[model samples]
Target: MIHTRALTKDFTVGRGEAVHAVRGVSIDIEPGELVAVLGPNGAGKTTLMRMLTTLISPTSGEATVAGHDIATHPARVRRRIGYVGQGNGAGHTQRVHDELYTQGEIYGLDRRAARTRADELIEALDLGALRERKVSDLSGGQRRRLDVALGLVHAPPLLFLDEPSTGLDPQNRANLWEHILRLRERHGMTVVLTTHYLDEADTMAERVVIVDHGRVIADDTAEALKTKLAGDRLTVGSPDVRTLSRLAEALPGARDLASSGERLELRVSDAPTAAAELLFAARDAGVPVTAVQSHRPTLDDVFLTLTGRSLREESSEVSK
Candidate 1:
């Protein structure tokens, strides 16, 4: 339940140079949809989220969140969306239950309803035992969950999570994912999240949007995005460099051919069909192929293929 048209955000760094954090981006998110925004750090994913959540105004363009015009009805938009930002929210001295109760009250919930929601969320988020514990004493994962509980204390229809699983262990990350899925399944809540974990996006999101250089690069279903990189990767182990070179020449779409120890790695569009050709070619050339393995392209492959670099690499470059 979010729509944006030609959204742009620019800031003047100094003299006259302007840094365009978000550039002419437009997207539509339907109700009850779990949309994952994938991007490098400076890809403007967070900036766009801020615009949608009414935390910041766009320099130009229009947006409607939960049927409220973000420019004119930001208060209504805020009331409809729960935003758990990158930073944690609960004060260090505030107890878990108190933090949630205060959040509910800020949203205009009565004491009875606030207490009820606090109790419910404390249990739902597995913070019942820590209800009386101060937030500073909680572990990173626990604190993150408490932040989410505070955000949802009012039970907003839409949730914006920016790297919600940051610093979480594998178990806690999976647990958070389960909670997010349940929110959608039971409450029909719309979730929009940004994450560095490609597997998380692959498993959780119904739609994937990739942004690069402050622009929308690709948007599609997770499967469809991976299919866009449709192909197989082949890794061959051989001692001879000549054999690897010969195999690369015979294989279509083979690039970045390199030798590591006794193995050669290169990318190919079709692994099953190409592996056989590679084997025969190596055989005729008297070069022995020790092992061959093929794997379908992953979301990382799609991102690297489209951007000529990995997501983490792009993010690092942006920070520089």
Candidate 2:
């Protein structure tokens, strides 16, 4: 449904110092796929999405969104895709239902169809109770839902969501995702979303694309990336740190070993089996292990493994 070849975008600030926001990003997204784009702040995630949505012109390369050239057929691309950006797109003074209906009309829907579609989306996104409320009066989560409804008023085949759930609480986030997943399932729409929530990307996305320094660093299913890049983590606590370290060093599949006082941590391809064997070895060697635990790798682990920086830490730094 979308294809790009070496798509890049550069911007100039004061003194004409160029900022490379997106660099040679080439990726293909198939129809009916839900892909999550993850990165830290200033990682060109928004820049890439803007280019794909034709909201901004790229400095170099080519991209086709929804089968229309983003540069040559921007209007056609806009007509076939819906974009819900990070900020609220609805006007504060407008009522929720009115704004949605107006957007439908702007998309060329007739009066009756526009009203019908507006009502449908209002119900679909759980905005029925707030239909008569002004956009400014709604809470952040409510406003985001209205934005999504406006984007889908035209029933476009593809949807682009840039940090749609960035500021919502856990309940609101779950609610938004429920509505989004339901809408996608009902319409079989292709969804490309960028988010800071690692757990969301790990659990929700069929595929993940990791961006850093305006480049595509990794792309694969969440499980595949975690297995190939991060593996599982094993934390062992022992009074005999030296003995535990020696045993960990001798393990065949262990790597990235670290010792912190009584705690020893390492990455292994199979943590469950490795943990059992390590415990047995510690007992036989009189290492006096105090505790042993295995943890599955998360998306953040994969990002850290690839970039040598924790994604969570990067996100926190960006927020600051």
Candidate 3:
């Protein structure tokens, strides 16, 4: 549903100092695919989304969204896609149902059809409870759901969500995703979202694209990237840190060995085999193994391995 080739965008600030927001980003997304773009502050993720959604034209390269060329057929692209940006659109004092119906009418739906779509969305997004409430009076989660319902008023084939669940609580975030998943399943929708939550992308996205400095650094399934780049972190705790360090150094495929006061941590591809071998070697060398634990790699671990920086830290900066 989406294709891009070397797409790039550059902006000029004060005194013509250029800011390259997106750099040579090439991606292909199949129909009905749920793809998440992962990145930190000023990572060009928003710039890329803007270009794909036809909100901004690229400085270089080409892209087609939903079978329409973004540069030439922007109107068609807009008609075929629904974009729910980070900002809320239903911030006005209009009633929830009226706001949605107006949105449907704005999309060229007839009076009856617009009202019908509005009612359908109210039911689909579980906004029936808030139907009579003014948008300005609804809670953050309720507002977000209303925003989503507005985006789908026309039922576009593709949807672009920019940080759809940024400020919501954990319960609301979970509820939002449940509604989004249901919409996708019901319509076989193609969803492309950019999110700062590592776990959200890890668990929800079928494929992930990691962006940094306006460029895509990694793209793969979350599990595959974790396994290939980060592996598993094995921390063996013992009073004798020296023996733990020695065991880690002698083990095959054990890298990044570090001693933290009394515990030794290392990166290993096979956690089970490495843990077992460490215990056996400790027994032979007269080193007592106090405790053994293996932590499976997360998307943050994969990001740290690739960029040598914590995505969580950068994301916090973005939130600020």
Candidate 4:
């Protein structure tokens, strides 16, 4: 339900130097699709989302979101889509249900309709207990759920979420994801989100677009990006050093062969075959294998394969 061409955004701070925050990121997202934009800090993922959501004007290029031109028909685009930003959108002093009701009214609903929508969302997001509490009193996860409810007040068919679970712990992140998925199922909404969590992007999103340096680097399913862009990893750990040495020699073309204490890890094109060959070779060499495991490459591995850098490490470095 979204299309863009050479979507670029530039910024100028107090000085004269220009910052190319988003550059030529052309992408298409289909209806009823869950697509995650994966990137590290300063990677332009958020810039791209802001442009599509019409929060900021693009310096160059064009985009159509939910059947309306983002540049010319920003109001139309906003009417058809919901947006949940990284920060809390609710006012601190407003009551939880009151916040949602006011948002619904702002979206053009009458008092009765707004109240109905607010109550429905409060129940759907499991905020019944916190309905009477002030927005400031809710936990981080509760506040985020309220944000999602606010976005859906108009019942838009498309939704945009920027780092929806950024600061939440593992359990709360999962809870938010569950609510998002359920809401999509109930409304048949198309979801487009930007996230730094590699595993969440891999497991939750049907499609993944990897961005770096304000450019589109990769776009594909999580499995395709992992298997085709990256590769499977094979690791064998044995107490007998002779066994690992023999297996390493037997595998002629294995890459990234490393010794971690009693373990040997290899980045290979085909992990199962390599693991089998290692087992056979170890047997022939009279070396008993203590542990053998093969792993499918993760989304982080895909990012590393495409950009020669780790997204987790890059984000950590930027945070520091």
Q: Pick the candidate with the highest TM-score.
A: 2
TM-score, cand. 3? 0.98
TM-score of each: 0.90, 0.98, 0.98, 0.93
Higher-ranked by lDDT: 1 or 4: 4
**What's the distance in Å from true for residue 3, model 4?**
0.2
lDDT for each residue of candidate 4 in 1-320, tens digit (9 for 90 to 100): 99999999999977878999999878889899999999998899888999899999999999999999999999999889999998999999999999999999889999999999999999999999999999989999999999999999998999999999998989999999999999899889999999998989999999999999999899999988887887888878888765576567667457767777888887877888888888888888788888889999998888998889999898888768
Q: Please give the lDDT score for candidate 4.
A: 0.90
Q: Report the lDDT of model 1 for residue 319.
A: 50
Clashing pairs in 3: none
For TM-score, candidate 2 versus 4, the one ahead is 2
Root-mean-square deviation (CA) per prediction: 2.6, 0.8, 1.1, 2.0
- Pairs in steric clash, model 4: none
Residues 91-196 of candidate 2 have per-residue lDDT tens digits of 9999999999899999999999999999999999988899899999999999999999988998889999999999899999999999999999999999999998
- In candidate 3, position 120 carries an lDDT of 95
The 10 consecutive residues of candidate 2 with the worst lDDT sum are 244-253
- For model 3 the local lDDT of residue 291 reads 89
- Decreasing TM-score order of the candidates: 2, 3, 4, 1
Question: Model 2 off-target regions past 4 Å?
Answer: none
